[model samples]
Target: MKALDIRVMWFQRALHLWLLVWLLSALPAAEWLWEHPVSPELGDPGIVSGLLHGFGVWMPSGAAVPVAIALLLFAVIGAFKSRPWWIGALTWLFFCALTDRAWLANNGGTWLMRNALFWSIFLRVDPSKEHGPLSLVPIQVLRLQLLLAYAITGLQKLHGTTWTDGTALGIIASDPTYGPSLLPVTPGLCWAVLLFQLTFPLAVWWGPTRIVWLAAGVVFHLGTAFWLGIVDMAFAFLVFYLLWFPEEGVAWMMRSLRITSTANTT
Candidate 1:
């Protein structure tokens, strides 16, 4: 297999593993989020629900947990299966159904995961054939999605007073729901974040600056996970970061893993 194909294959497996972890973590709250109580109308049912409804296949309240479980199982299969094409499709559909049913419980991370799963449907995971030109299309779409997300968010932040005045991070630090009250926030830190987001789309495409920006992204997401209490969101973005990894980076990782495995056996 070519380097790009290898990278794509690894990325798919890693993404599936991350999705499995996420689903496992959410299992405890399945009853609350999917089974009963709470505001379900807070989120729109979206196109998936509409399509299901059109087909006269409305998801019953009792079906939500089962669907969620199925998705988790499919994710596990996808992680290990070499040819997970149809499995990936089913996973995405089940995910969309669950998310649509319990939209109120979801956040940006959930939507990002949904989008990633959608693209995963098109990813060529077959190990035998060399993925031709079409395989790169879905990968490019994933890359564009991340770039667009950051670029648009940064632009929107520029229009907002809080981000422009460097009060955004300070405010986030004080928020009880998402942030730790005792966490220190600085204006310079706020602007630095803004700068990174705005420049990431452009910088990440350049070879020299790609590694630098990706390294910064690691710090950024890790800080969000630890300080802001947004572990899912942080992991979601970090998972997508795998797509930006150079081919050499993937080769190096394989070598390191082989060495570690050898050492473990000895």
Candidate 2:
């Protein structure tokens, strides 16, 4: 297989794994997210939600746990066999249904996952290369989506005093809800985050700076996971990073796992 194919395969596998983990984590919160006071309602927030509402597919509040369990099962099946593109489509539809119903619970991470799942519907994994070649358009779309997210976030931060004055991290660290007491937030660290977000879109495309930027992103997300207690959100963003990973990097990962050698020997 070519490097591009390898990267795409691994990207699909990693994305499937992330979805499985995400659904598993959300199992316990199923009732809270879909059955409580903030449960599903018939509303046309977007085309998809409108269609769902039209079809009377808005999941009933009482079915939240069962629906969540079904989605988890679909995720498990997708993780085992990524070629079933319908799995991705079904998952994305269900995700849209849940989020649209409980729009109050929607966040940046939720939207990101929605977009990723939408893109995944068009992707297929065929190691045998017997189904012809895969289109690169969806892959490119995911990459652009990720880059735009960072670029826009960084630009928006510039409009705020916290990020500009380098007090954003400090403020977040002091927040009672999301902050950790041990975080050593500083002005320089705040500025560094701003700069990294603004520069990532440009630097990550260049071979020389790609790895450096990717490593910085891993550290940035991991830090947010540990310090801000946003583990799911952090991992959600980190999963998109696989789309930007270089072919060589993917190969290195396969080698580390003995996958490449095992396949070669077979």
Off by over 4 Å in 2: 37-42, 45-47, 52-55, 58-62, 127-134, 255-266
TM-score of each: 0.87, 0.86
Using alpha carbons, what is the TM-score of model 1?
Answer: 0.87
lDDT of 1 by residue, 1-266 (tens): 44555556777887788889988987898877667735444334466566432212465657777777887888787778654578887787778766665677778888898899889889884445655678778988987888888898899999889888879988887778876665568888889999999999999877779999999999999998898778888888888888888656766676776522111100
Please list the C-alpha lDDT of all candidates, in the order they appear: 0.76, 0.74
Candidate achieving the largest TM-score:
1
Q: How many backbone clashes does candidate 1 have?
A: 0
Determine which window of 10 residues in candidate 1 has minimal summed lDDT: 257-266
Q: Which stretches of candidate 1 lie over 4 Å from their true place?
A: 41-48, 52-60, 126-130, 257-266
Model 1 lDDT, full chain set: 0.76
